[model samples]
Target: MADELELLRHANPVPVDGPHFGDGPLDHHAERHLDRLLRERPTISAPSPPRRRTRLAWGLAATAVVAALALALLFTGQTTAPAVAAPRPLLVQADSTPVPLRTLAERAGAAAADGAPKLRKGTHVQTWSMGMSDDKPPITLPEERIVRWHADDSHTEIVVATDPRHPGRPVLGGDGELVADGHVLSRQTYPPSWSDAPPQSPPPTDLGRLRAYLQEAEYSRTALNTGELLHAVATLLDTWTLGARESAALAQLLADTEGLRPAGQVTDRLGRRGQAYVYDGTGSRQMLIMDPATGDVLGLETTFTEAEPEYGVKAGDVMSYSAWMR
Candidate 1:
């Protein structure tokens, strides 16, 4: 290989452009000595190409590129790669026997009004969201397992039975502060998930403050505007963040409402499904829709009423709603 490379190097060696350095005869001892050194030293095998060789090399390169492109097209059928099919919207393997939305709403309503414990316990196979965790990223669990919804006057808790991956119990308590009451209890919080900092901002202007203000106001002294109430509801919906209980409750509410549109249902980062409602309070022109059943506040849709398309408010379009999930 070394001998072959040497031969190739000699054959391909580039010629000097300038006059030869050894044209004249050696005149002195110093010149003779330098000449001798030059003669003794082997010439470096220059890889530089002559003009004809350079042109030939470029031609070959261009030909190779064209051939490669043709081969690629032969295999792929296009110069550009094919567009990946939009990931099929994840089709959750729903319960073979799903508890009706109305059933859930009735139970939630009863629980809210009478503080009666109305429970719906079943097994849920779901891809858990990271927002549901305190330390780890969201992971998908592929198995049927027992899970229970415990509802009472003030709160509802979802408890997932022990599994090998997460042995003991994984519980989401909603009766105010999530109390881990299950054996080997693992608790999940709402928007508070994985957050270590305290909530520092002022309470939301429309929901927290306005609700308080309305409650404090004397109903006899001033007649409340239904328009304003609708507005407040829209604000509440906008500010809402679905945790374990909040999201479920919000979904129930949207489903229960007689005329509300529940289409753009969304799951949150925490994997709760709910929707948003937009309306001009005190008018026939109201827009009520659910976000995608995957993420919080993803988008919305209007109710059955045929409203102008111009009124459609979409995800990534940030217009404050008149109310939100409390």
Candidate 2:
């Protein structure tokens, strides 16, 4: 059951490395394509996670935690990518006022390109809905998870856990040229038994096989773990709001958000009237919805990775997710 849930959770979403950081290796070509679009367009929609209160809180806290760690990682080591030129886009003028999508795209691109670590970092707390086996549970490392990432021409290094208790104890891996050079790193959760499965019926459908591909490709850990769904949503919205055509595939994603459901009439705290893409999944699904016009995400739903007889996911269940480019 646990394996099945994990399989579907990861089947369609971006791959994630582990609990903290992910740097396996993604489709650089595909990422570049998305980057090109964002760098040339003026407006785009931002991504958000399911709106369940528990889940929404987890997502926001996770992002805040990672964002803080990213700043630290940036100061320790610089991540450099080949500089690419910006693209040209159409501009319109009305009543002596001119605006170009190119400008928006450039600003977004510069932000991404800069990728500089912030000089001043803020403290953010993260809460997780963790579940382990009945007989033996997965151990929580400690408070203040320190997630770190390093990307160079050769490899990407990701480390989790930096609190005083376990100072530098971390799980690490890399991909791209590192794998090409035949440097295979061993798994961290020793004995593989750390993630054992109970005797159960048949596994999930073939659709679940996609997870193996995402894992092999090395997507960001948060993306696969359901922690970064909102980040992806925000990125999408950022693009869509800029006048980018909304793809049907992404519309479906909006539909599945845990809190968003079709309604005859809907308005947010700000009183904007329109169909909102909200997270509506169980376990605090009411908090992720917000006024799409303003791009304010307020909540998240919870998903515990480990097995639990009482609260965690069970076997024979099916989970579906969709990803898109605006």
Candidate 3:
């Protein structure tokens, strides 16, 4: 009985490395009580016929009492502490002009009725990317790329690396060659079928058919959501030229989408005025600029809405942007 009591006395009730909900360490009062219980050995009266059994029973009772008291302290500590709240969304500035999203959509739809430009035989796109540089102070550097894809899937690309801070300075190619004189740094041509074929057919012109096409064509492999749909539509416009009917359908689809908010009128990087619509997705914010006069997509930009310290990206930093024209 004494040996058992000694073993119980040394047993630690509080965990040293586990989840603790309490705001502070174990209660001082509880610790003192535990110490006292372990130190003050109970004295039993003179042995009876079942003296051994009596002592064993007494030791077991003491162990149970100590365990109950320890549990009470732990639970009390947890219940008294307050819970932590979730983080709030970061704030971002929007254009001052306030226009209803549906109103802009209607105007865009009307403009689309005017007819779209003739479809060309190839896809041409220009893109700009801003990213962290290796230098001290870690300023974002800008790079530009132009992609041209033939109707048969053969493609060519020209890349230019420029320092945004020194726009007038000449940029050099990787091979120690001067590329600032409107010369391509490096160019490669891929044979037909070297890559996946571009959308050979234009997107559907009806709202229902377009919605279904967008869902299956773009987001079928991944879980679909309103934000993903908006992003897919914006990406589609970047590559595929939309006619009046198709553009009107797209405008209507966006107007009916939940959580699509108007960000008012803003000038794109190309100095073209357009209505902006914003969609908040997981860890990012996508802004689509639509030309209200011609019902055309003028530009698209995505910015980070959450801080990703691992990537050294702060909230509100523009990740990438593209301005496109047929």
Query: Using TM-score as the measure, which candidate wins?
Result: 3
Which residue window of length 10 is worst by lDDT in model 3? 48-57
Error of 1 at 198 (Å): 17
* Per-residue lDDT over 1-326 for candidate 2, one digit per residue giving the tens place of the 0 to 100 score: 12212222232112333232121122455345433322332222232221211111232333443454465457646343111111111111222222122232233334333333221111111112222333321222211111111121111111111112111223111110101111122111111112122111111112233233223223354234322455444322322221111222223233333444432223221222222232333432222332222222221222222334553344312121111111
> Residues 1-326, candidate 1, lDDT per residue (tens digit)?
12211221122111123122221122355334323322332232332211110001122333443455456558757544321111112222243223334444445444345322221222122122111122222122111111222232111112221122222222222111111212212222112122211111212223344344333332223533544443333333322233323333544544544444322333322233444343433223344333332112222221222332333322222222111111
Candidate 3 colliding pairs: none
Taken over the whole model, the C-alpha lDDT of each candidate is 0.28, 0.25, 0.49
TM-score of every prediction relative to native: 0.22, 0.23, 0.57
Q: Could you list the CA RMSD of all candidates, in the order they appear?
A: 32.1, 20.2, 30.7
- Model 3: what TM-score? 0.57
Q: Look at candidate 2 and tell me the lDDT of residue 241.
A: 22
Better of 1 and 2 by lDDT: 1
Candidates sorted by lDDT, best first: 3, 1, 2
Tell me the spans in candidate 2 whose CA falls farther than 4 Å from its real position. Answer: 1-129, 136-155, 162-299, 303-326
True-structure lDDT of candidate 3: 0.49
Evaluate model 2: give its lDDT: 0.25
